[model samples]
Target: LLGIARFKALSSLRKKKEDWIDDDDAAQVPDSADTPEVVTMKEDKAAALRRFVDALPEEHRTVIDLAYYHGQSVTEIGEVLGIPVATVKTRMFYARKKLGEALKAAGYDRGWP
Candidate 1:
């Protein structure tokens, strides 16, 4: 069940282009449009996300890096990691849950959206 949730989350994220803005382009927003506080908030969120991922356990972190950073499918992750697809899914599920909790604790009260 959790694995299914993780898969859905990844699918949703992939479909929602607006949710994943490139930092370089984000920074190019007109000066008149962005307040300094907004810019700082973005930076802080990015930093927190990085720290969260970096702090994850190796097994969980590996699955996240492959799925999100490398754009690998669950089957592909299993192939690369020499694990079963189910195992990959489980790790991804737990990793995403931890990330959501961390973000929530960091003031992203909406959780994973």
Candidate 2:
């Protein structure tokens, strides 16, 4: 009985996460009130990432979508994608580098991390 109950709870949690993804897909961008660069840096990143999604490779794009849009942790993303956590982090690293290049080429003066 306890095993079945645990299974049911896990199933419900997975469904909830799926529902959240659907909602995220429907979410539209909101205009942020401009402030200083430091303040914007902390909160503006998700928006920035969304804007650059099309430029990402499918693997990096899916990982980021799971993490940000689906509100998943790195470990969760790893589990979902059947990859190790280290690999997920590597993809994120390369993804950031790619985005940095694109942004710089577009004339945005985003400073180094």
Candidate 3:
């Protein structure tokens, strides 16, 4: 029932898109339409990042989230968490290395969006 309603919602959304975009931008979409440069990376990059976060150790996740997702400085995160700056730095390092390793293992190092 939820899925059906969601599908209907999406069906309505597709119709609504016609109103949101002008004919010029509508034609620009690839097959459907092309995305704007503001989007930067494609959906693959977002999926890869999600996978990286899921595979990371829990303890390091906070540091990674703070530094990568929130744009917080390592020192700022340390201050917020009441941990030493070095510990925060170490966590950030390990988190990045682990995410890199995970992404590499998934065969996404070079071809990721």
Report the number of clashing residue pairs per model: 0, 0, 4
| Model 3 agreement with the true structure over 51-100: per-residue lDDT tens digits | 77977888798888888889999789999899999999898888888877
Predicted structure 2, TM vs. truth: 0.52
Ranking by TM-score: 1, 3, 2
Which candidate's TM-score is highest? 1
Candidate 1 or 2, higher lDDT? Answer: 1
Residue 16 lDDT (model 2): 81
TM-score of each: 0.62, 0.52, 0.59
Report residue 47 deviation for candidate 3 (angstroms). 1.3
List candidate 1 segments past 4 Å from native: 1-37, 110-113
Please provide, for model 1 over 1-113, each residue's C-alpha lDDT reduced to its tens digit, 9 standing for 90 to 100: 99999999999988987667799989987767667787787777877888999999999999999898899999999999999999999999999999989988877754322
Candidate 2 Cα misplacement greater than 4 A, ranges: 1-51, 111-113
Show pairs that collide, candidate 3. Answer: 29-33, 29-34, 30-33, 30-34
**Model 2 residue 94 lDDT score:** 85
Q: Higher TM-score: candidate 1 or 3?
A: 1
